[model samples]
Every structure is written in C-alpha cells, then in structure tokens.
Target chain A: MNDYRITTYEPRHRGAVVEFQQMLWQGGAAGNSAYLDWKFGANPYLDDRYVTLAWQESELVGMLGVFGSCWEVDGHGRVMLPCLADTVVAPAHRGGPLFGRMLEWLVERLRADEVPWLLDFGDQPAGPAMLMSGWTAVGPWPVAVAEREVLGSGEGEWSAREAVRGSRSGATITPVATSLPEMPALAAETRSRGSVRVVRDEEYFRWRSRNPLARYFHLVAEEQGTVGYLIAHRTAVDTDDGPTPTTIVECEALDDDVWRDLVEAAVATLPGKVVTMWVRDLAPAREQSLASLGLSPTRPSGRLSQDIHLPKLVMRSTGVVDDAGPLATLTSPDVWDMRGVSGRGWR
Target chain B: MSGSHDVQDVARTVLDCLRNKLFLDGVTADTHLIESGLIDSVGFIRMFVVLEEEFGIEVTARDLSLERFQNVGSISRFVIEKLAEGGGSDKPAEAVRA
Candidate 1:
C-alpha cells in the first residue's frame, strides 16, 4: 500500500481497469475491453479525466467513472452534471483508507473544475459509504410492472437464429440499428418537455444504444418517428414463484397513442416477461398510460430499495453551482418530473 | 508469519483504518463491528480492501457472506484460509493481479 498512487485514467490503463472491475464485480461486462472502449472511449460526451484510477505500484486496485451528462435543472436550464457509476475497489484494499482517499480526490477535482454536482443510483452494499460522504438519496421513485400474463402471449418464443425484427400495434419494434439519422433531433425533441433529466441528444442515443453488454429495442410509430425504446435484461433475483425477467422503458414525450403502441409492441416482442421501470410521481398521466396497457404498480420499494437510509438517487453537491437561484429545487427529488426516465436510459 | 502474528497484523491494519478514516473507538477482536455500529456495509468493504492489500488476497462475492466477516477473529480466519489456498500472497507473481 506504501507504493499506492492515484491518477487520471490513460489508454494504457484500459486493461488494468477491466481487470480491476472483473475482480470487484466477479466478472461480466467488466472483463470486456470492447465494452470498456464503448463506455469510455467511444462516448462523445466524456473528457479525458472522466475516470480516476488508484494504483498500488503497477497494479490497478480501484476505479471510479464520472459519466458526464447535460442535466436540465429546472431554472438553471441545462447544466453539465457528472453521474458517478461503475465504482470498484479491490477487496483487499476495501478495509483501508484507499476508497475514501480516491473519493476525496475525485470530489476535489470536480470542485476545482467547477462541475455543478454529482449524482448516483448507488449500489446497495455501498450505500453507507455514499451517505457518510454527504450524498443524499432521492428515494426510490415508483416502479410499474407489466406482467407476462397481463401482457398476453402474442407469439412463440423468439428463436436465437431469428433477427429481432417485428411489429405490433401499427408500429415497428426492431433491434436498434447502428445509426439513425433522426435519432439526434428526435431525442432532443423528445426530452424537451420541460422537466429535470439527463439531456438525450443524438449522440447520447447513438452511444447508449451501442452498449456491448445489453440490447435495446426501438419502437417507431409510422408517422410519429422514434416514440419509445426498451431494454430488457435478466436479474439474479428470484421470488417465491421463480425467476422473473426485468425490462426498462422510456417514453416521456410520446402521445397517448404512440406510448400505448410502443408498450404493446415491446410486450409482444418479449412475451411473458415482467417489464419494470421507475415512474415519476409528478407524471400521473404516464403511470395511467402504462396502467391502461395492463401494467400495475408493484412494491419494488421493499424488495429493491438500496437501504433503509439510502434513497435510490444519491446526490452530492460540489458547491460549484448556486442551488438557491434558478436551480433552487435542483436537489429536491419531488421537483423532477421524470416523464421519460428509464432504468437503462438514465445511465 | 506465525498464525497469531498474522492475525494480529490483519486486526491492527483493520482497526487502524477504522480509527483513522471513520473516527471509531473501543473496537476489539470480538466486537460485533457490523451489528455494534462500528462498521457498516461500506466500512466492511473498506476493511476487506485493507486486508487484501495487506495480505495480497482476492476477496470475491462468495466471500462476502456474514459468517466469514463477522468480527476480527472470523475475518482473520477467512483471510488465512484464502491465503493458504494460494488465492493471493505478498510475493511477486509472474502476472499482475488487479
């Protein structure tokens, strides 16, 4: 530990970063270099120092990624906010001061650079540390689920050889293409409904859809453009009955018909699966829209809450912005009208 | 190193971190660190990190169960077993381990 040092991430450290995440998370996308490149390298919004690395001599012991985003904070208009994600520290160094040291280093740098704020959807096991470091949990937003039975089995199981190409409810739901000319303008138009959220411009949509680890489906209403998208991923969690599938949906600025069509199309694509996503309380209409399509409000709070003390959206201020002015309600979770937010879309 | 000495070194590393980083006090080998408020899940993560760096071991998700990390004695025993299995050591290896 005496040889330990912290520095900004470099391309040479890519392999080490992947290796550290593999050890910390017990291997998954963390071990994939292509995923790392897609996440950090290919991203159009990140700076060179988006990642901070901790090294014990030549070994990469820790990593914390500060994923940058353009956040619309009510009165402040749009401010650049960094979302803390994919934090990992070697287990041997967990009980030491290394983690704290790395956090302080990152916070101070962000402050010095005048970054407005830091936000995170915290890891449950790491909740105590986050709160202890002056982070505020914004509480788990209400989650809605469309169960398999209610969604109704539309077609047989999707075969592996078959491409994810289909349609339902007068819309085309297909695997997202590498590039969509309308994605940039459509994403900006979709998120311009005047609410607090991560700005999803054309570049964001393209980069997010390119995630090597997860697959996303786009629902395009004939004349409505890109109305919605869904990312359905499996979770290790199990209920009294058995294993259940989890899906995240985002369709904030869509018309009623488009939204319903997208939901039906998504459900038809992945039949008999439980689709789940966080819904903002301010947007009762969105919840109502999903409910009308057979989705129900489930008690994901008790089973999925990060911790009793830790809220779902844990935030920390860098004192670089004035929260009292136009952004007075910036820290208040109640003020965010999360109409188009989805589980995968937020990151 | 002797087993007791190794355990003492591990305990000292963990306690020193608790006192310095978290401002904790009066913790002992048998203290219920997690249950007694001396350490939370985050603190437990820190402790594991220090132990790994100090002894050169790779603690995995399977090693996170409460039984293996209840107290100083339990933690030391777990580390000693992991070290004995040659999971990690202070000695230099041919390949780098993150």
Candidate 2:
C-alpha cells in the first residue's frame, strides 16, 4: 500500500483539486474549478512550482497551496515571502501522518528553493500544526469584536452608521466597489512606519480585496484628504453559540477619528452583525483604538485549543537560520504586527 | 533510534522544558498536561517549538487534537511516526522501514 506520491500542481489536476477541496470544506467554500483557478491561478505571487499535491494512487488526497507575498522584513528591506494558504486533508485521512508528510515535503521544497520565510494566518487545526512544524507562534493577535447586542442578537434603534455620519465631525464615509486610486500611496506610507507588515500596495489591494467571487467591501473616510480606508468582508460561521453573520474588517489605516467613523459605518451598514479585525494586542495605542470599538482580546491556549474559534497569528522562518540578524528580528513578536481580517478570508 | 528509545527521548525533552519554565515537579507519561493546568496557552506554544526543533518532526495543526497530544505517550507516538515515515501517509511506520 505504498502508493503515496507527491508532485507540483498541473493544469490537468484543476477539477480534481476542486473536488478534493470541496470534499474537505464539505461544500462550505464552493471549491469549484472557477474559484480554485481564481484563487491559485490569479495570484500575483503564485509560483506554479510551489502549488503542491499529494496523491494516494489515483486519488488527490491532500494539497498545500502557497501564495507569494511582498513583505517588509525587519533589516532586510522588502522581500518576496510565500504565505501558505489553504491546506486540506480528506476526512478519512484526517488524523493520520499525512498532514505532516505533506508539510515536510512542502518545507523541503521551500528550503531547496531558498524561500526566505513562510507567513500564514492559519485557523486550527492548521495553526497548531504550523507551530509543531517549527513555525513560531506570534500572538495573542487581537480579534476585536464589536457586538451591538449580547450574544450578537437583537437590533439596535440607533444605527452606528447614521450616528457617525450625522455627527458634527464633518468627516464623510463612502463605500466604494474597488480599491481607491490613492490607496497605493497610503499603503506605501503605512509600510514606511518600520513595523514588520505585509506590502499592501495597489496591486495587493486590487487582487486581495477585490476578488470577483467574494463580496469584499471597501469603505473610505475623508475630511481634508483621504484619511483612511477599510477593507471588509461579510460572512458567517458555526460557533458554539449558533450561526452568526460577521463583518470581517480585513485591513485599515486611519487616524483615531476616521477609524471611529469607518467602524461606525460598518456597524451601521451591517447593523447587528458583529464586526471583527486582527490588531497588534501588544501595542498599547492599537489596542486602545480597537478597545474604543468594543473588541476584546481573545487568546487560545494552543493552536488546537477549543477557543480557536478566535483567530491567531502564527509564522515560521524558511530562511537561513545561521544568518540570525534579520530572521531574529522577524521572529520577535515585538517587531512583528498582524493587522487585518485574516484566517480563511470568506473565500 | 528505536521506538522505545525515541519515546523516552521525547518524554525527557518535553518534561524538561515544562519543569524548568512552568515549575511542575513531577510529570509522567500519563500526566494530562492540559487537564492538570500545567501547560497553558503560552506554555503549549513554547513546547511545540521546542519539540519540533529537537526531534525534526513536522506537527500539523490537525495533529493537535486532544486525542493525539493529551499525554506523553500520545505525543511520543506522534514523534515516532513522523521520524520513522516522514509523517505524510498513514501506512505503518514499520512497513515503510521493512
């Protein structure tokens, strides 16, 4: 029964990959051919060589997808980093050695190709897997949830959006369908702050935030010039409580006042839906701003901890370990920051 | 390393890290790390890193299920399988070696 084989992804395996993913997701992600193509195919950072598949004879049993990212690593300037995306092992194979085998193969490839670092916002049980696979766990990444009502039920009489707009602050919040033209410059300015962050340039915004299949919303608030923008997605998840719609705030760059206005707009538009975002829990100023929006800090005991319903930020280095200067800085939680709506981004 | 040898090695490494950092005096193979409140969220992550580096095993997220990781014996079995067969397929580690 040694029918195990692994290889790089080929176009011929598209349908099979979709079927495999659909089975793994249990139809929640609509892992059809089109979605897979757009996700893996349209990736600006996609290296055809990096998309990997594991097969048991004729069956596509497992997959590890890697998306290319431009990241600002401390002391290294801007570098190309690969983010490990969707990883799925079929139901029958869930608790076996297959996951580690696939990952070992993936890591071997990364080491051979000289990929610098691997970045991912993995939801369990993959998050814990990453830590076990020699990836550094960096958290408690803040998941700020703004619940209008307890248990996220009951609608409020006053709309956060209307109140925000009606205020005497004079800032205006407008929702747009695409990334704003000014976003490229603003994103560049954001990276100039010296925090380890994703390079959210114009290309990244257009590709990541403007996917055709997903209903990602871009809301911009401005008073004098472009104050800031918020990238949001709406989706639901099955929790211990129940199924609840959530407004996922993907990424944002705003001053305190404008941040307030944009969050207000999201709360208004979604009304009762809970709003969530990833913030640097260690940073006092960032935590204070999110606290103002009513998001509490949720940390899981381990990647597999039951509370993993909350999000976590985990990373690992694929770079030369001996050249410890830059990698050491990257490994430090103090220098690194995760600010976005991550983890299986509503497709 | 033989299976039993590897198991003892893993148990030693795990217990040493736990005892020094969290100050737990006695931890046996059957000790429930999570249940006894010995390894909290922070300690669990620290332990994961140490084991992966020491044993050269890849521990995936799904493998963190309580069934496989709740005790020293389970964690040792996991490391053995990974080391023996590279942790990809469910085929018995002995079969691959044979």
Candidate 3:
C-alpha cells in the first residue's frame, strides 16, 4: 500500500495533527495544542495554510510545518520567509519515500508562493535526511556551555531574578516581565557587523516570549540608558542521563562587558544548572568574555553520536532567486547572527 | 587487525546491529540500508552508536557522509578503515553509550 496522498493543512485536520504530534512531542494533547497554537495559530507572519500533511487514505501519516519569519539582510531591510519545523511521520510509514515526498510537495508550494528559500535548524536525527533531500548544509555550529555543581537541589541561596536586580560592575541588571520598551532601540544601536539576522523588533520579542514550551526570562542592562538586554529560557531535555535541567542563554547584548554582566547575572540565577549558548562566529571580545565567565566551547563530533550533535542550519532554494541574489549571503555561515535563532520546540 | 578478518567481523557486527538493535530483519551486507527504509535518521544514530561501542572507534565528523553509511557493506568498510587507522581507543564503552 504505497498510495500516500499529500495535502495542505486545514482547520478540520487540527485534531488529527495534534494527535499525530504526540509521536513527536510526547507532551500529551493539551501541551501539543498549546505549542501548535503558539507556533502557527497566533504567528504574526504565516498562517496554518503553510502546514503540509501526508495521508494514507484518511489516516494522517505524516506532517511538515512551515512557519514564517522575518530576516534583516545587511543591504536589505526586511525579508519575510518560511522555516521548516515540527516534522513527524507515523511509525507504520517509516523508512519510505514519504518524508521526501512531503518535502517535495512543500518545496513546490513554496515555489508557487514565490518564496526565495526555506531554512531548518536540523537536529542530528534530521540532518542527514535533510541533506539527502537537497537542503544545503551550512553548519555544525559550535555551542558554549557553563556548568557548576549545586550544593543542594533548587536555586540554593542565590536567586537568578535577585542577582540581576542587584547592580554590579558599572551597569545595573533589571529583570522584566517581558521585552523592555527600549529593546528595539537597543537592538538597533548594536551593529550587525554585516550579518543576516532575525529582526528583533518589538513585535518579534512579544511573540517570542509567548512560547508555551519554554519559560522565558528577560534582563535589561542600564548604565546611562538601556545599553543591552538578555533573554534566557529554562527547559527540561531528555538526555542520556535522563531529564537534564538546561538553560538556553538565547540572546544578549553586543557589548562585551555588558554581555558578560548579563550572562553572569543569568547564570547566578540558576546555580549548578547547565547553561548553553551559541558561539558560532562569535566576536573575539565576546568569546573572551564568555571564557572569563568560565564558559567553554562544546564542540560536537559531527557523528550524531551520544554526545550532543552540533546543530546544523540547512536551506533549500525555491528557485525564486538568481545567482547574485541573497541566497549566496544566506548560505554563508559567517553571515548569520545566530543568537535566539533556536527554532520553536527546541527541547 | 587482519584486513579480511576485520572486514568479516565488521560486516557481521553491522548486520547483527541492524537485526538485533534496530529490529530490522533480513538486512544483508549489500542491502540498501538507507534507500530500503531500513535505516532512517534516528536509526542511523542508533546504528552509529553500536558501531562506536562495538569497534571502539571514535566516529568523527568526516565520517558522517551519507555515502559512507548507505548499507551494511559500506558501513563495514568504513569501520575497517577506521580500525586500520588506529581509531580504537582505551576509553570505556559506557562513556559513549546513548
């Protein structure tokens, strides 16, 4: 029975999609519903129409969700594009052309819609398959980590929130409930250094803070004004050692000293926890700052082994761009400001 | 580390892993593990772990190409080459178990 049909997602398929996601998420139906809603249902750029589904008759056998995002190319102001995520296929349909077929359909749809290209932060299990499906491999990006031994369970004596609230080293760190009003201005003030990055506008920050799967914390640094800000989130990941408490230091200030202070305060909050942040193409000053803070680069073996597989960004053209277009810029690993680029459902 | 003996041993181990660890029956040395749907992405990782543990060879980034892992024969050859290059280590196998 190799008769698999491909179709775009509709409202009627919501229940099936949620149910199908349990195989991938294992977060139960309610959790899956909330994640789906946050990622696509309430997205500012794209709608549910971009979600593609595969079926064997009426059974929902596979799905590939394409969500919208905006990028700021150096010369270009803002370019909206789709990113592939939340891919799942039924066990009964394993090891077949179903994945390739769904991808082919999605690419065709993106081409029809005139999208220039699509991106995926492909994990270890998904990396090779994506490469085989024609996605260009741009990275096995490096990540930096700082870990400390906790005397006891819980936050111990120091509180992450309290640490930031207390001032140190010229700048004051203040924890905010959401993105600071000065975030856009602060982001604008920081130079991109000729890289394509996610547009960190007010709308993007507000939307990013609503991710239900992650508990986000925002900290703003002020010396004279809003010099910098940091966003970190805590999530539990199932590692080889069981559920590990992990804090992703998602984004921070561009200034080395301010960035160091922000990170120090953030790490102080979650004492003894494993803290990680992207370090690919990091500036020398920032790299030194992280090292001074006791964080070291954790390089992946690229074998997709037991150790954490290096996160690779994969892309494929939709045939909408010429040779001299933005595709060349996007393909270069050095051209991405990777902070906070970790996709939805990163756990 | 005799070449022919090593190849045979690697092939046997690869086939055993596919059938036992990955639960894929009838996987032969020449079977197209990838194209035949016997090994998907997750399966590929699991298989890599078995190879690393069984051979005590550190699988590096350079060894990650799809062509190198397409089938039992290819995987066996890759393992033999790695073993020949003194890739074996004294590190405990438990350290790399996933």
Q: Which 10 successive residues of model 1 chain A have the least lDDT summed? A: A301-310
Off by over 4 Å in 1: A1-4, A24-31, A74-77, A146-195, A223-246, A271-274, A289-294, A299-311, A323-328, A339-343, B1-38, B42-98
Better of 2 and 3 by TM-score: 3
Candidate whose DockQ is highest: 3
For candidate 1, give the lDDT of residue B35.
60
Rank by TM-score (best first): 3, 2, 1
Between candidates 1 and 3, name the one with more favorable lDDT: 3
Each model's lDDT: 0.59, 0.60, 0.71
> What digit string (tens of lDDT, one per residue) describes model 1 on residues A42-96?
7676665858888888888888877766667665677766777778877777655
> Chain A: TM-score in each candidate?
0.76, 0.82, 0.87
Instruction: List ranges where model 2 is wrong by over 4 Å.
Output: A24-31, A148-168, A191-194, A235-247, A250-254, A281-286, A289-292, A299-307, A319-325, A344-346, B1-98
Alpha-carbon DockQ of candidate 2: 0.07
Could you give the TM-score of chain B for each candidate, in order?
0.70, 0.67, 0.80
- Per-residue CA lDDT of candidate 3, range A1-347, in tens? 67999999988898999899987766578877887888888788888787999999999999998888888887666888788888888888867788888888889988898888988874635565666556776767666677776422232222234534424456888766667778776776766655687777888877777776665667788877777787766542233133344455454564777877887876665433576677665567777677667677765444546443556777888887667866566877778876557643243
A best-first ranking of the candidates according to their lDDT comes to 3, 2, 1
For all predictions in the order shown, the interface RMSD in Å is 14.0, 16.2, 5.1
Which ten-residue region of model 1 chain B has the weakest summed lDDT? Answer: B89-98
Residue pairs in collision within model 2 = A98-B88, A101-B87, A101-B88, A125-B61, A129-B60, A129-B61, A250-A341, A301-B41
Name the docking class for model 1. incorrect
**Interface RMSD, Å, model 1:** 14.0
For residue B70, what is the lDDT in candidate 1?
69
